[model samples]
Target chain A: MQQFKTLKDLPEQDYFTGGSSACAGCGPSMGLKLALKVLGPETIIVNASGCMTLLPLYPNTPLKASWIHNAIENASSTAAGARHGLDMLGNKDMNVVVYAGDGATYDIGLASLSAVAAKNERIIYICYNNQSFGNTGFQWSTATPYGSETKTTPRGKNNPTGTTAVNKDMVKIMGAHRVYAATASLAYPVDFLNKLSRAKERDGFSYIELLGACTAGWNYDPRLTIRISKLAVRCGMWPMYEIENGILTLNKDFSELKPIDEFLKLQGRYRALPQDGVDRLQVLINEHWAELKEYNGQRYV
Target chain B: MKQTLVTGNEAAAWGARLVRPNYIPTFPITPQTECIETLARWSADGELPGTYFDRMESEHSVMSAAVGAAAVGARVFTASSSQGLLLMHEVLYIAAGMRLPIVMATISRGLSAPVTLWSDHNDFLDQRDSGWLMFHAENNQEVLDMMLQAYRIAEDPRVLLPAMVNMDGYVLSFTDEPITIPSPEMVEEFLPEYNPDHTIAKGRPVTVGPPVLDEYTIFRAQNHVAARNALEVMEEVMDDFDRIFDRRYHLVDEFMLDDAELVLVTQGSMSTTAKAAIMEMREEEGIKVGLLRLRVIRPWPAKAIAEALKGAKAVAVIDRNLAPGRGGIMFPEIVETLYHLDRRPLVSSFVVGLGGNPQTEHKVKEITRKLIDDLETGRPRVEWNDL
Candidate 1:
């Protein structure tokens, strides 16, 4: 992971074109842009059907590199084939990357991701966690945080807890396979770029989950996409960490974490969460952070 | 050439081994599991050199991986059956629309609600309009031969579409039959190395499966044109194959149909029984009954089918799979093919061999006798060969 003193030190090449159909202040777009910046032009992107599928609609596409849009749940498997195919063609230098969404990654595509990791396929898989199915008008997905208001988990007059289920820990699941798994955010471009670069340099299966903020889905102002993401990590809602070769390293260490309400109140989805719900969520976050801390700079026994 | 007694599944594996595909992404499914097992064993024994083999989690992943490999300029192969084929249904259209030229072997079997693992065309017929060139093999020999020809047809520049070579589930998949295995040099001359014009490489960038709005119709129309062009391309490939290997193939094979008044149209393994019935009807019964076996169903082979059944008084389509209320699936297709003829033959449907029941020679002869009677009676448009 290389560090740049300034933003201008980054490469000038743009693999992701400007005219994308993504919404304004799209966090996933920024993550994709930065990831591609590190990956450069010698890469083939296997994108699952999601918001990214809409980027290249019809004859027009915003991808400057060779890209394929596969079914929602098979991006990892598709990229595995692409890597093997490229290897068979004697073009081992080309990188095969899977750009997928949370619904495709944490839910329907988890089996494929697990299989790819088990097989140790040489490819980079990036999951843009937008909390819900943003492409289909914000249905409740497994990655959606507890108590988040979604189409399927609407906050009704009778039911106060919008979504009772907690968000799936995909990073830890990938860690179980002992593959290089990391968590990054668009809010921290430099850190995100560093992790993305390191993931690109790895040989076998590598996974990175990027915290992507959705303006319409979360009912947040389009201008605060990066601010909301930063608040998420600052309040201990989303941790910044990496697990490489069974060794876990916490990228952002905070002695005193901010309250969860400061992050929850910023989004409309969590507005109806009761005081008790917030307290319980805070306790869960604290316990999760403590568990993650044990792995900081430690190897799995 | 070496002759070996092997099942259809083993023949399919031999065909793939001879082709030396760069990648094989497959999952095990009943009747088709042996094919993948053979491939895995070959890969372990170092017999499959330079091939990347993976047992995918599901049929969907299998097809997806094959698509990815094909898109990256690799010759790919995969196999599925029954539920497995249905699982891969969605990716089938993508494979053809992208024109990746991946080859798959499907062991025809009945779909499950009752969980029957038997020979039937329900699984194969369900994917009729999936934009893939489909070929049905009558025996293990054709299974081995068609597997080799499928690549040549699919990779043809004029017809860059995915192809499926289908053999009946247990009848061919498990039944042992004598087949000639071609040498590596012979197969090399038959199917030259797959050199794709376009791929997802670093320097060559292309957007595969991009959304198509107003131009969707044109792309679909072009696919139809390409699919139709496969008929000619297949004919040329088969001619070349015959010239090299001395084995002839036809889109629709005819047996004793030159002076017959009744023809029993069949597909898959049932065609062998139909041929035997034709022999018995001609020699012992003194009935001029013939057999018409459909080899390629995708480009429809309407011209060849209609031409073969032109002089016949009536045609009895012995479909091993039923289409529920619509009678035998192939019956209507054959009737539709001969609709514009000046004197169209009367076509009757007979459904048999559902759920792997044997289509015995006696049953086929009964269907032939019914066809002979129907030439004058014109009664019972559809009948089922009762178990």
Candidate 2:
């Protein structure tokens, strides 16, 4: 057992170490670091094929904790197995957390994760939504925003296509399972950590949607990763909220929604949008915010 | 020293009860449901302690919840058949890939569309490459015994892979026979409480299921190799079981194969009929005949099959399931196992008893008798379509 010096005084040896192949200032890396810090040494993680997987399993990497690499679509199931292994060994005090990308969580892994969460199995599932399949070179994902210029969605289209399909409402979808579900952001460390800590204390399945930034794929200045993250929440593009036992609570009250362009302009993935395209994107964002507002819940902002 | 008539399904449940896993996530399905119901009843009666009986919504969820519970370092158990196994197809690969030693009982049933709740090898046969140690039980005794042995084999450090113990639906699963049930205390002595060397439990933390690239598939492959190596441990565990319970089973059981010209290789409940047919041919016709019952299918027990049939002039593999255009599913594996070997015997493939069609004593006799005639005629058909 190691001693904790400060909250960030993490193991001297990181749970997710440096030298990972992740581009500089990847929010998923920092999010993982903070998650391990709070989860302590008594946690096991299940990761999927995304930036998190690429970096962690990169050659000659220094890893402080034990890990299993599962398929992108089955992290929750894999983590569930690890959790059961822990219980078999009489380690009921352990935390089993599965970290997946937006593609894995919102699309392929959606059904299995939903089933496990609905059963309220004791586990933590964190969907690190980088908005696209960054490991595969910025392909548009189900979580990709409208008018975002991804490898597939090269030019932000004014006309609706399949690419314009609404980003899956995973947080609410998971919430509907009556398990603990929350949307968090890497930029909001205090709020993110608080939710993560609370998730750890829960006895059943809990999920936190992490608004992670992919520095390379998103074509952003790595240093502005935190800024991009905060802009997303402030703009109502990525709301900070939690749902516990079917009751939703806003982590950041959206009293005055910021323009979505501020968040869009930070990443090159959304740079192809023309003026009218930005207006359409904002309209969509506004419509989504209206629904968030009408959702009968206590505002925490 | 008491004997009670037990079906393969009952024995599976009895076997699970002996191990006393921490959780059993199960959804009721034909043949396989009894395996979990017995465990649930035991859990309710205090016969099994500290075990969670999760009645999940679907087979997918059953395996999913078991995976989650097992992820937290819990010894988990579940049972399913046919469509249920197919429902868990995705997670089955994940479990093996993640190196979670989750033990599940799969009662073999034909796959669906024209779904029938009858005995067939197609269920587990289709999943042969999913990287799980597949054990086919030939009788109620082996079904019960394999359930106990599967844990030791799957949990072995060399083979930290999930395993499926398969019994033919209705045939062995529903059929009752006298099975010696080991005392829980005795089983605890035989297979101690599962203490995983690597688990993401409370004090000791680890990350399971990280991502791997195509090149890093070697890591996953190595895990599979490790699972294959666990077959040796199965032999040791069975030996230990024999010493304690006085029943014997070869990882691949062979009967009267020495100096034989023809050998019939089969698995699951059909092997019993095959053995009877081989005996009848040997006694009445004076034909040199024998039967090789495959107990372990995942690792394929190629070495055992090869060694047992070494001196035989010809070997015929009787499969209850087809691989479609290719003929018997098990035949190709057996052929591949012996393909590179020096001095291999003539191997014939025959597909029979699909979609729960009974492989009666007559079918086995007809197949083996034909193989004998072909050996004598010197023109044995290596592949035959299902009759």
Candidate 3:
């Protein structure tokens, strides 16, 4: 993979438009723009039904690359078909990439995506993880982190915590499939682009889940999207990491990780988090961080 | 053409192989498994060059992948049966709404609740409203012929729609019959290479199957127009198919319709048994009963159905499927078509086979005798014959 020195190293030819109907400071829109920079126009974007489905709302689209939206839960399999379709047409240089949502990736589309990873089809799957079903007014999804409030997981008299279940360790699941799996953040464009470049270099399946911080769902200031993303990594919440061919690599490592309070307080979903909830979240993050450090630069799965 | 003994599954696979599709996405289900197994073996042996045989996890993914491949302008073929066909029902509309010309072989089986692995028309007719061109075959020869014709009719510029060529399960799928497999050279001359203009391609960026509000009506109307276009396109396709292959097929199959007072309307392989009964009734019983087998079901073939039944005194619409409260699924469709005719014959509905309860010559004779009774009484009856 060719490493870019800085953000300016991105090519001038962009395939994605700057803005559309998406909320201001949408992390997924940024992730898409950056990913398109690496993928270019010789690619087909297989989109699932989500917020991104509106990107091509009848008679209008912002993409210079070809796109197909099959359904909500079959983006991975659709990409598999597109990949084989191109290969059969004797156009192997083109890329097949998927842009799905957290609800699509972590829940409804899991089986479809797992089949692709198992087959090791030549495709790239990008899951824009906003932690909930943000398209449907912030409903709880399997990707929703613990202690976070969503429409379906509202805290009431009987329930002290909004969501009690932990987020899925998706990167580990893909790593076990022995393919290229990674976690990226909107705050780290260089890291995400670098991972995408590496994924393009491989001739098999790749899963890259980006931390798509939602302004409306998370109830944060539009201007603080990048800051919140940065804090997520600094607080050991969203780690900048990649697992390739069973080898784990931690991209951003902090000697003294910041406290989780700074990251939680910025978003309204975590505003009502109790002291005990914060303590439990911290313990979980610390344990995961310790495990990553131990397995760094080694076979992790 | 080479005359060989093969099952309906093998015939469908041979059709796919002769067409040389760019991709085939498949999953295994009983009665349809052998079709994909043949493709898989050929793919492993490197017989299918420039083609990718993909094995997907489920029928839904199989069809999803077919849509993805076809959206990129690659020819695709797949097969499924019963519950698998039900699972693929959602994407079938998407394939047609997007106007992707994909072809699939549907081996019909009864729907599950008791889970019978036998042939019935419920699985095939359930997709009647799905905006796909539908065809049913009576023998292994027609199975292969219809598949080749399906691609021609589906991929025409005037009709960029998907098609499903159906044959009865167990009876046709597993049983062997002599079919002439057309040569690849003849198939090439008959069906041209699929060069679709409405798809995703390099330097031609497009968004397929996007969301729309009120504009949804216009797109759906286009799907309807295109499927209706298949009615005309298929006439030309059948002509070309006959000119090259020396075999003929019409929108509706007519057997002994001339100078007949009683007619039986049927579909799939049961038409063969009904035809045998008609000959016996003509020779001994002095009954002028004929048969009308529905070969082309969608773009409904109403005019031909009316033309064939125009002279009959009473018509019996023998359905191999039961729609619960509704008598026979095709009963209303046939009745509605003939309602406008000047001499509208008395139409009776008979729901016969449910889960491969055999449709025999005696059952066909009984159905004809009942139609004679309806003709005498001037009243139509809806009865379950096989019960």
Candidate 4:
């Protein structure tokens, strides 16, 4: 993997072109730009129906490499097919990647993702986790954190906490299939790029969950996309970790973690949550962090 | 060519093997499972070299993978039936809209309510407007022959569309019949290696199946034009096939339609029983009856149907599947086909043999008798044959 000391040290050329259909301060778009920089133009991307699909509308595309936009829930399987087709065409070294969204990866597309991982298909599956269904007017998704207000889970006068469901543990699910699984955040470009480069070097069924922030869905300031992403990891809401070949490794070990309230107060989705609700969310995050530390054979903080 | 006794499922499997597709993404479903198992076995035993066999998670994924492979310039094949076909219904439109020439074999079976494992046209008829070219086979031979021809018709530049060859589930999928398997060299001569112009590769960076909002209408119109062009392409391929194998197939096979007063329009294996019924009606009862079997359901043979039934006194459409409130599935299609005729014959829809119920010759003769009776009064336009 190529080591980059700073943003200036990265490749000058961009595979993800400019003037995309994404809105201002789109974290997923930034993640895609970085990903294309690492994977290069020799890759064929299979994009499931989501915000990423909306980026390259017909007659206009922002990709310099080959891309296939398919139905909502078949990115992983379609990438598997592209892998097989490339092999049949005697181009075994060409990379096939699936760039999808949180709703597609964690909910609708999980079956296909699991199936491909079971076959150990040589494809990198990346889920741009924006917490909610960002493309469809901010509906609650399986990756949406508890107490977040979405179109489907609007905080009413009687129920001020919005959604009561916790976020699904997708990295652990992929890890259970014995594939290489990792979590990265757009706020940390170096770490994200490093993880992507490492994932590209792996042989089969590599998965990365990129913490993508949605300024429109979360009702945050457009300029605070990277700030909120950083707060998410700093507050232990989104931990950066990797599970390679059944061994867990935490990438970022904060000396003093920020309070979860600092992350929750930044987004309008969690504005209706009471003090107790924030405390409950912090407890859940602490429990998950302790479980990860246990998996790493370290004493719980 | 060598003669082998096999079921329709086996015949379809043999046809796929002869075509030697580069990729096959399939899932197991009843009656269609035999086809997948046979292909898997052949692939495992080294009989099908250079082929990538993908046992997909579901029928939806099966078609999704097939679309992926086909879009990347690979000749792909898959099979399903009934519920599985319904599961793949959404991607069916994707395959056609993307202009991927993926050939699929569907063993036609009844849809569930009270769940049946028998044969019906409901499964195939439900996908009528999905923009896929549909071919209905009567016997094991036609199953084998059409499976090979479908790939050529779909991959034709003028008609780049996905196609499905449908055979009755129990009637043909389980029944054994002697079929002449074509040689590999002959099949290779018929269908050369697939080379797609619009494919996703290293040198060519194409965005396949992109969202086209403003120009979506033009894309849809192009798909319809391609589907209509398939009629000519299908005939041309059948002509070449006839010249090579000495077996001819028409869009609509007519039997004793000349100087006939009554005609029966049918499809699938029921056409054989209708043919037998017409013979008996002509011999014993002196009724001037004939049979018109629809070989291709999509890009319907509207002109040939109008010509065949132009001077008839009445036409009876035997629908093995019902469309609920709308009566028979093909009745309205045939009625619309002959709507422009000056002296149109009386058309009646007869719903029979639904949910895999047997369609015997005796029941078919009863349907013809009902059509003859309707010619006098013309009271009911549609009737249940044995209900």
For each of the candidates, give the backbone clash count.
1, 45, 0, 0
Fnat across every predicted model, in order = 0.72, 0.59, 0.73, 0.64
Question: How accurately is candidate 3 docked according to DockQ?
Answer: 0.81
lDDT of 2 by residue, B47-98 (tens): 8777767666667767766766665567778899999999889778877776
Whole-model lDDT, model 2 = 0.78
Give the root-mean-square deviation of each candidate in angstroms. Answer: 1.4, 4.0, 1.1, 1.7
lDDT of all predictions: 0.89, 0.78, 0.92, 0.89
lDDT of 1 at B153: 93
Model 3, position B337, has a per-residue lDDT of 96
Candidate 1 residue lDDT tens string, B1-387? 898999999999999999999999989889999999999999999999989888789999999999999998999998999999999999999998898899999999898888889989999999999999999999999999999999999999999999999999999999999889989999999999988876676688888877778998898998999999999998999999999999999888999999989888889888887788788778997998888999999988889988999998988888888877777888778888989989988888888889988888888888877877887797636888774
RMSD of 3: 1.1
lDDT for each residue of candidate 4 in A1-301, tens digit (9 for 90 to 100):
6877787777888998876999999999999999998888878889989888887787888888888888989988888888898899887877899999999999999999999998889999989999988899899999999888999988888878788899999998898888888899988888888877777877888999998899989888999999999999999999998887778889888766799999988888888888888888999999888788678833222
List TM-scores for all candidates, in order: 0.98, 0.88, 0.99, 0.98
Candidate 2, A84: how far from true, in Å?
A: 4.6
| Residue A154 shift from truth in candidate 2, angstroms | 3.5
In angstroms, the error of model 2 at A89 is: 3.9
Among all windows of 10 consecutive residues in model 1 chain A, the one with the lowest summed lDDT is A1-10
Compare the candidates by DockQ and give the number of the best one: 3
Q: What is candidate 4's CAPRI-style docking category based on DockQ?
A: medium
In candidate 4, stretches whose alpha carbon ends up further than 4 angstroms from where it belongs are: A1-6, A297-301, B378-380
Q: Is candidate 3 or candidate 4 better by TM-score?
A: 3
Query: 1 or 3, which is superior by DockQ?
Result: 3
Query: What fraction of the real A-B contacts shows up in model 4?
Result: 0.64
